[model samples]
Target: MSESKALCTDTELFAAALFQLQVSVWERTADDIPVRVEDGGTIERITPVSVKINGIYYVRSECEFRVDRSGIKS
Candidate 1:
């Protein structure tokens, strides 16, 4: 029989298996219209957790696929 355990840490789980996660996100805006100012502050948090699946709760870390998205391909 195979044994299973709830992941205690992200580092441990990442070392074990390859995870493929897809999720939905939303933009944050104070005004009703969108801004085109690139140099200005963003209206939205990147990869913000707007949804959840099963019994999982995506805090801040879970919102991003990899902690290091620049080095990671997926």
Candidate 2:
């Protein structure tokens, strides 16, 4: 399945990243496209942007999820 998400504001950056990013099911693959989440870095900010995964794309909405701090260390 392919998905695409766009960020409306900086707050929705992670939501876009996380949206494109896959969790648990294929956590190991994240090592390749860690671009969304800075390596050894916490989600700082995000701007309205387009993301594509598995030939699919999605738009970030206002309901996107946000984090106060880095969800992961590595």
Candidate 3:
């Protein structure tokens, strides 16, 4: 019998690992809040961004979400 192999490329695996690390840092340091969309959806999960303001460094979190419109009423 042949052995199974990983389906993802090396670059893909590295990107996934990096994303997990970012998520860990965000969870530990960011003040995460779930925001409700006007179209009846929720935005969760934090993505950290680094910024320097007046020589001070800070980490800011941004969110990206998709809304489900199928259940919305017209």
C-alpha TM-scores of all predictions? 0.20, 0.24, 0.19
Q: How far is candidate 1 from the true structure (C-alpha RMSD, Å)?
A: 14.9
Lowest lDDT block of 10, candidate 3: 20-29
Q: Write the per-residue lDDT of candidate 1 for residues 1-74, one digit (tens) a residue.
A: 32223333545234322433222222225764433222111112222332233333344443322222332343
Candidate 1 at residue 45, lDDT? Answer: 23
Show model 2 residue runs off by greater than 4 Å: 1-49, 62-71
User: Candidate 3: where is the Cα deviation over 4 Å?
Assistant: 1-7, 21-74
CA lDDT, every prediction? 0.30, 0.34, 0.28
- Compared with the true structure, the alpha-carbon lDDT of candidate 2 equals 0.34
Number of backbone clashes in candidate 3: 0
lDDT of 2 by residue, 1-74 (tens): 33433334554555535544331111113354323321122233343543333433333331233232333323
**lDDT per residue, candidate 3, 1-74, as tens digits?**
32212212334224433433211111132456544222221212223443222233334433222223232234
Comparing candidate 1 with candidate 2, which one achieves the higher TM-score? 2
* TM-score: the better of candidates 2 and 3: 2
Off by over 4 Å in 1: 18-74
Worst 10 residues of 1 by lDDT: 36-45
